[model samples]
Target: MTPSIAGACGTRLIAQVLIAATVFSGTAARAQESVQTFPVAPSYPAAMPASPLGASVSALLDHARTTNPAFAAQRAETAAARERIESAGALPDPNFQVELMDFTNTMRGGGTTLLPGQVGETRYRIIQPLPGWGKRELQSRAAGAKADQAAAGLDAAWLDLATEIKNAWLRYYTADREAALARESLALLGGLEEAMLARYRQGLAPQQAVLRAQRELTSQRLAQVGIEQRRRGAAAALNGLLARAPDAPLATPADPAALPAALELPALVARARARNPALTADERGIEAARLERERTWADRYPDFSMGLTNNRPRGESQSWDLMFEVMIPLQQSARRAREREAEHMLAAADARRDATGSRLAGEIGAAYANFTSGQETQRLIRSTLLPQARATRDATRAAFETGRADFDAVLEAERQLVDTRMALLQAEVESRMALFELEKLVGDAL
Candidate 1:
């Protein structure tokens, strides 16, 4: 080969090597960058420091009231709504007028003895409109209804805020339990993998056993990944509900030892009907609409005014006259139509309120029933199924060590144990969530 060709070929080879190296370095860096940094899963906090149910409920409600923007906005709006009453009851301020007289001429030769006088009048007058046909009273009632609706609206806001907080708390509880279970499963799988590796190396186990163990370990690792993700998500949601940063640490009381015992459906329905804030708000809206229709009726009549006026001519004494002004508009087709529309709106609001109350009653009944059923299921699992599965696992392990139970039995037992544990955890989680939902639907007993 010529020296020049050789040099070119050498440079090409160097370029290829550089390109390959660059590609590999880029891939490695991307892989590292794609990896996530997860927060250390902190252990569950201690049980609630407070014991009185009322106090605990109040604390939670207070936290939500302050943290929830919806509730805060409603409070401010209700305070603003009070101004509407004062505004509605007030009459228009009286109008004032001022006038000045300039030059004036009196005809002297055009008449006989009577003076043919011209009055260049300057007059000052005040007009105050008197509300006719109980308009003021009707307006005051409407304003009062509006204020009532706003107050009820604030209650609804607080209710929703409280429900959101409770839901978030339950989610955090679920995350904690699931994460704990995942960690425990990981540890157990690790032990099994070690045992499988030892047996395989001793020639007592097939290579496939080691492979299977490795696969199981990897599966659990993946499960842990998902569990951690949920944990972080739950934490972030709770923090946001409490008006903190998504990553902010939270201190939550541990879940209760057991779910509440079942209650009669009738009682639950009653509670919901009495306390559901959304239902209350709807009722208030209906009342406000009714009052609005009444006020519209009063608007059909016009107001009246009475005033005194003074008239003076240039270089002459002032004369005063009392005047009364009455405004009677022609038949108001528009006002009548508006009154009918208000009536229909009031009817619609009333119907809507009734529908909401009915739905709330049904929901509370269903939630209570499901919650109790779940509680029973969890109790049964904890008392019987889980313990039996655990005993089976222990027995299988003992037999394997003694050379009686085969590898298949050991694996089967392990599977059953895992399934039982998972089922129990799910049951517990469901029961807890159901109870939380029930309480949210019906205000806390306390």
Candidate 2:
């Protein structure tokens, strides 16, 4: 080919390559947008509540941890279990007896002898019992396992308490925000109503416009009353969690717990399996069950007892005697039935542990989904829809003032903006709750 022809071909090839690169870049950007996920939690609402409660959520959580009667009761249970370990391995209390032998001979003399020396024979005996072979150890081990299970349960209780406090705090925050947002809307509508009345008086707008504005304002005020009521109820619930009186005042919730970075389902599942209190308790239950089964089997063995007796004859020297006894393990059917019961219980414990693991995975999956969706929903509203709705309302109201648009159009736009704000608040609360729920399942902060 000629040099000119070759140069033209090279230029065409470079142009084609650039075109392909542009297409690929656009595709990559679209793909990234489709799969975008928040690695860290979004910022809390920039605006804080006007009414301040007495304490922050963090403080409330700490107070609940320290003062909640449930936790103290759980601790007491653990201590009680530990105390039982020694009792489980203890021997039966010794038995003591006093006997009058040859009482007929004494009575034959036509006189009842009250004294040991006057009787033909008198005896004193004591016996000490020993538990069956290996029974003490098994019993002690079972008790120890029970104590362990109690400890695990205590850990689970902590997660439960945290979940409750965080959830209640979120509920209060949602209601507070909703009430505040409604008030703002009421004020906005009131202004619009005044303006619409002025326009109606001037014959620039219809009377219906002013009437619609008044209705919306009244409806908003009524809704605010309910929202405030719910907020107060939420506060009461939170106070109860903190072990305070139900009517005790609580501070407004500030921000939600920060979300974990690079949240991954697999990682969360791993953490849950390793540390989830419920799962841990199940494992402890399995161990306790196994020990209990062993203890039941140990019951098939015989228990032994030893005794000593001192005998005295009237007007004679005393004699000492020793005796030993062992329990006969009779009733094979009863023993076997007990063993079967323990076996079934152990199997139940194993099944329970496995089921908990399965449920843990499912819970983490659900929480992860909720957390990601909520964050994305709020982010979209805050970044795009909220602003767009606000702009639409402003534009429509301006048009209505100029007699270029209908009053209903302005009302519709205003309603849309209010809904968007409400939705944003709901999403924020949802995201916060989901993140905390995830942590509760994992038994620790992610």
Candidate 3:
């Protein structure tokens, strides 16, 4: 009986173990099934982040100033030039030296009373160089002018960077809007294709209509792809210019809202002439060159060095002697050559300044004209063409549904409408870019 009981208990233990093992295995399988496996594929949507329309112009300018290599380099140069101004005005440190004198005498000289020697004399001397009248002031002015020129260069760089960033941002937004328009066209084409297929099935249209619709859809699709590719390429290029990663996704901005009212050409020109950093920089260049030429001649007058020498006699009967020396300018050939070179350089600088001024004026005029033209064009498109085109598309669609028009007519109407909208968007973008260019030339409106 005890043996039977033992066998029964053993069987129960084995059953419990098997039950536990089955439950654990089932749970493991369930967990495995619950885990999801993803494929190793690059996803465009995953890489893209949500960016709303209309980024800030101020932010873009800030980014350009901070990131642009040319701007950074110019800023560094300006700082270095400022440091040079301090160095240029500083006086040379005084030099000090010590000398020891000793005499070796023979027995006959030591015993003889002809000349007695003190044996040795120690001396200390200091030499200081003093600049001539107005020399230090000239040097200081020249260095200050150079520093000012560098500062002007830095300002120009900042203006240029802001302008470039604005233009690139406009182009990027334009491409994005164009891509959106292309996608809308593709959708319209798809709808047309569906209509054409339906007509063919009903034996109301020929195979040619279906083929035509298919071809149009494919073309629209290709166009959408091309526009998207262009957008991406433009974004990458802008990012490169801004010193950002090429793969960083760009955010599309909304169309510029409105134009600045009371646009006066004369006022803009005057502002640009006065405020433009490029013109100011050129002006500073002319001054710097003139000063540089003066410095060449001024430096030709050799710097004066005064030295005082103390001579200590070996004999007690001899007194100490003092000698003073001065160095004179003697290299006439080198000085004349440098002077002539500086004069020629000054002339060249003046001529260059004039040429730059004329070019800057022309650029300002061109940018102003473009801005005004874009504003008018955008106004016309917005206030007239776009509305008319949209109304025409609606009418055509209604007429076609009522059998008063055909598919071809509706398609043409839709194309006109889409084109008009896109054209307006482009005009707005172009106007903003032109305004940016104008502002760059003018330095700042505020």
Name the candidate that leads on lDDT.
2
lDDT of 1 at 400: 59
| Per-prediction TM-score | 0.77, 0.82, 0.76
Worst 10 residues of 1 by lDDT: 36-45
Clashes of 2: 3
Error of 3 at 384 (Å): 4.0
Worst 10 residues of 2 by lDDT: 37-46
The local distance difference test score of model 3 is 0.64
lDDT against the true structure, per candidate, is 0.64, 0.74, 0.64
lDDT of 2 at 219: 89
Q: Tens digits of per-residue lDDT for model 3 on 184-267? A: 567566666665565455454568877877887888888888888877887787787778888786555533444565466677
Per-candidate RMSD, Å: 14.6, 14.9, 18.8
Q: Where does candidate 3 stray beyond 4 Å?
A: 1-54, 93-125, 296-302, 308-324
What would the per-residue lDDT of candidate 1 be over residues 60-110, giving only the tens digit for each residue?
455555666766778999988888888888887887765543323233222
Error (Å) of candidate 2 at residue 253 is 2.3
Can you write out model 2's per-residue Cα lDDT over 1-446, one digit (the tens) per residue? 23233344444443343344334433433332232222221111123334454334555555666788988898888899889989988888999988887665644464665666566788999999988789888888888888888888888887788788768877877787677667666766766676666555545556677788788888888999999999989988888887888888776555444444448888889989998989999998999999999888888889899999999877778999999998999989999999999999999999999999999898889989998998788778868997788678667755664457787887798789778777876776777778878878888865
User: How does model 3 score by TM-score?
Assistant: 0.76
